[model samples]
Target: MESARDKRTGEIVDAEQLWIINPVDPMGYECRGCSAQATPCSYRPENKVRPYFSAKDGHNAGCDVEGEVALVKRARKQRVTIREGFPGSFPNRLVLRDTRPVSSPDGSPTAPSSDGGRRTGSNGSSERCRNRHWAAQTIRPICRTFINYPFDRDLPLVVPGVTADTYQHVFRSLKSDQVIQYPEPRLFYAPISWKASIADDDRLEIQLSYGEWKERKLTRPYRVRMDWTDWSAAKRNYVSREIETARSEYMTAKKRGDKEKGWLFFIGRQDESDSTLFHVDDHRLVCCVVNEVIYP
Candidate 1:
């Protein structure tokens, strides 16, 4: 059997630790002896150990591979305690997430009131509700697809610059696009600037993944995305129109006051000529996306 010293207990053991080093960030784990950390390298063995805890005590258990079962259980217990006060004095203390199962008592909640009158959470936690009446405006009924667009407007947009001099202007142009417009109450911003290789005869493509305030309206980890693309700018004027449209999106978002948003961008040239340009065409603007999509 393969054996190694246990890290936490510092005990020499026959059972090994199944450390689950992140596939993306190898540096997540380190050698306790050498104090050397692992980086992203294909050289490491395929079965890198990821840390996990489970039944079968000691090192005998397969641990985390079974999934984060323990964590999920804890979440359920916490939710229950919050929604149905933990057998105690303060009934009002119990609170449920906008998406909790059912209240402690299926019927109604009555908390001791200062004035001696009973207070019921029949209406629930109204203010903190995800769909709280608190909105810029009552959202107009919208298609589910349309409503699911990426929105990151509350944040700033950060686009990397090309030339120190022209960079600002170009950035300003793209900066304007990241803001969220009216129809959708959500706005998005991201700093997108990366280098990529393009082959000849290949069409240029840019993928923009954005996010919005969570669906339930909880500011937690809720977000959406929009895939904007334009194959070939067959009609030069149409390409120009698309650019104008992208620019227009920024203008519209800015006017609505979502100006501080940021977003990402990539430039790649086409290879229809049988030669690898690698760089985008100066005459033709990037056409990976067309038209600004708005969600109401």
Candidate 2:
């Protein structure tokens, strides 16, 4: 599973977050859908595979999470409309909470459900639940939904500081080596260029795939500059490790003849002086995903 509920705090945490935690609690995780024990896997720095949670003894019968995966696949095959709403559950908003609460008023974590709290209709077709949208603690899940449901780009979304309402308008792609004026800030993403990335104590400079290419060499590329001057050592290490892991995953997929690319997603403003440059400071606002056409 991409995420699991922390029994200690009742907060649903993304598997990728394991990198940031100095000491992970071995027995503090459980399945989000059932009372099954979940084990963290491949979370060590040396592990080549991405981190994820696995049920130790398998899930209970009729586990909501198990059924939710199937529902997502079925929804992907169907068409979506604004009137009918999204066929499956999705994180409709991003909520960055400074402190982790024990639980919400309903005694449930704010993390989104895999199935969007689905039910069956008279004809046995999956029907939307009353609570369709859920809150997300990180941008990773939102980015995954954005990539998974390309056809449903018109779905509504709410991100703090961003003016756009729909997914289509919220995400903006960086064009190659362009210094165009950006009147408004949005969640921008670009393919990572492994050859031109820099990581140091001062900051991280990442070159995007889109850039000036000549004789098969990228002469100039769009870059993201993350200021780490005020960040803690642990926070800085987490970002560095994430980038390295993404590069490794991308190379492994290429060696296996898989079509995969590493994408960097962040919500930041364009450089007023250098339009090709974007400055990001918050660690929570940035994420890296490696996939063929979609990501988790």
Model number with the top lDDT? 2
RMSD of every candidate to native, in Å, equals: 23.4, 5.6
Clashing pairs in 2: none
TM of each candidate vs. truth: 0.18, 0.81
Q: Write the per-residue lDDT of candidate 1 for residues 1-296, one digit (tens) a residue.
A: 11122222222111112221223333232221221232223223343332222222222233221222343344333321233322111111111122212323432224321112222356753221111001110011011111122131111122222222111122222222222322211112222212221223333322233323345331322111111233343333333333343444544565777732223232332233422112333222132221233321
- List residue ranges in candidate 1 displaced over 4 A: 1-234, 259-278, 281-285, 288-296
Q: Give a tens-digit lDDT track for model 2, residues 213-258.
A: 6888666678888888999988887877788788878777878998
Candidate 1 residue-wise lDDT at 23: 32
What TM-score would you give candidate 2 relative to the actual structure? 0.81
Model 1 TM-score on a 0 to 1 scale: 0.18
Query: What does the lDDT read for residue 186 in candidate 1?
Result: 19
Poorest lDDT segment (10 consecutive residues) of candidate 2: 109-118
Find the candidate with the highest TM-score and give its number: 2
